[model samples]
Target: MSERTHDGGVAVTAAPSPDESLPAADLAAKYGLAVSGARPSLVEYVRQLWGRRHFILAFSQAKLTAQYSQAKLGQLWQVATPLLNAAVYYAIFGLILDASRGMSHDTYVPFLVTGVFVFTFTQSSLMSGVRAISGNLGLVRALHFPRAALPISFSLQQLQQLLFSMIVVFLVVIGFGNYPRLSWLLILPALVLQFLFNTGLALIVARMGAKTPDLAQLMPFILRTWMYASGVMFSINHMLEGRPEWIVRVLQANPAAVYMDLMRYALIDGYGAVNLPPHVWALALGWAVVVFCGGFVYFWKAEERYGRG
Candidate 1:
């Protein structure tokens, strides 16, 4: 380019560019630029999620608070909803079907309530997880935090609701002549393991739901079937009395059944260790660790695909 000098003579000059000889990739590297929504490494993703812990917690609390705000009973429905479910199950399974044949009324009532409350924890988690990503598309697209937070937050919200509902569980158990004891303390560990398991399951479903929004419509039937197979209203041992040994073992080993069995044994006086399959605690831990880790990795795998076309 030519420029006029003060002396009126034409001057030819050129400016040098540092990036003139570099390719696009090299230029991006030189400027420390990264793709806007590229997936991070697994370790980095974990770190990112950890850094956003406050957001996860706050979001969960906010969701939980707003969950029934518009209802007449508000949060009372959290406890009442499951209790009502227990009543219906008790009527059909306990009275009409004689599912509670072995257990007395005192034992059966608390048993059914505990099972309903505990299983609802997982059921709600999975249901919310299916909508976590798809339901919050606006937030996912508008924010840059780890997508896992959405599902994790929803799981946390369910856990919070379960904790609130447990007060009734305690009263029902006490009302049934099962007083507070050391074993009741076992609920803490059981709840923790269940939370881990639920969170993991939520992560898995969140990813699936994001890819196929129609999955939300189908989850209710799947969950209802799971509830029946989980022995929510009846004992697997009692109901499957004549079934094959392998079938009983498989049903007892199911994570949902395992968790419910643990809680029932811990809370109900009639549900002794004999009611639980061999190594029930070990099964609970295994399910929690396996599902939580697997779900985290599975959800993280599709991190970049969330909120995309």
Candidate 2:
């Protein structure tokens, strides 16, 4: 028998018998309940992810390199694909449809590229996260890496693509005499916030997708609708003129709209016009924290069952 402290009073407690199991901590490093005192908060969970940064970097590099392993184009496809996307959209929106008629931005191409590139990262992260666990059944069963690493790796891979797209956009901006401004520097922090948002979203979707494989199929459609709603192809402000002020306010409530607005403000408007107000940034950061904390706890609760199916 073992004696243990109790809140009400000292009580005698029986220890596990020889045939019974040891505490969870001794079974597996990954299986123990997070002690109340030592358990990680959402920020700490993200820091643990940061501590395993090498794994995320290695996995992202592997995925990117493997894309061209057998192909002649190799990694060139990364640049080629986004270049093609920009060209197609420029042709359709800038030339054929003349969609930028009354937009505040000077040129349409750079605007379109910035919107599409930034939005693509969100789309890819969510879509890939939905299948992260189920797609890695073999590794999930055989390895003990942090499950969050999977989605983080996927987000990093997409970030690589986003970086390439940014380079291309920069060159285009230079050619078009749209010199980058001091505000462009904000891109880095905006990207960090965007990454946090994606990571949190991936965690939530990954758990849901694992339980219901059908989520994988529906993600693309949801993303498509989300993109349209996000104002990626057009300016939201242009459509809000006749609508109720509350409707426009509600649209602004969408986090993606805030993100893209920040991008446009930084990349095209040169920062002064697009600088996020303190209130807006506070709101965005609040949303990110809520999503990340909510998703982290929700997903952590099911860590043990992720590998079962």
Q: If scored against the real structure, what TM-score would every candidate get?
A: 0.94, 0.80
Flag regions of model 1 displaced more than 4 Å: 1-21
Candidate 2 weakest ten by summed lDDT: 269-278
Residue 77 of model 1: what lDDT? Answer: 93
RMSD of model 2 against the true structure: 9.2
- Count the clashes in each prediction: 0, 0
RMSD of 1: 3.2
Model 2 agreement with the true structure over 1-309: per-residue lDDT tens digits: 645576656676778675346656765454544543233566766677788899889998888778668979887776677667767877886678766665544556667777787888898889888888988889888876567888778878888877876887787766655787787897887787887888789989999988998999999899888887876766665655588867766676677877777777777743244233336676567777888777778877676677774
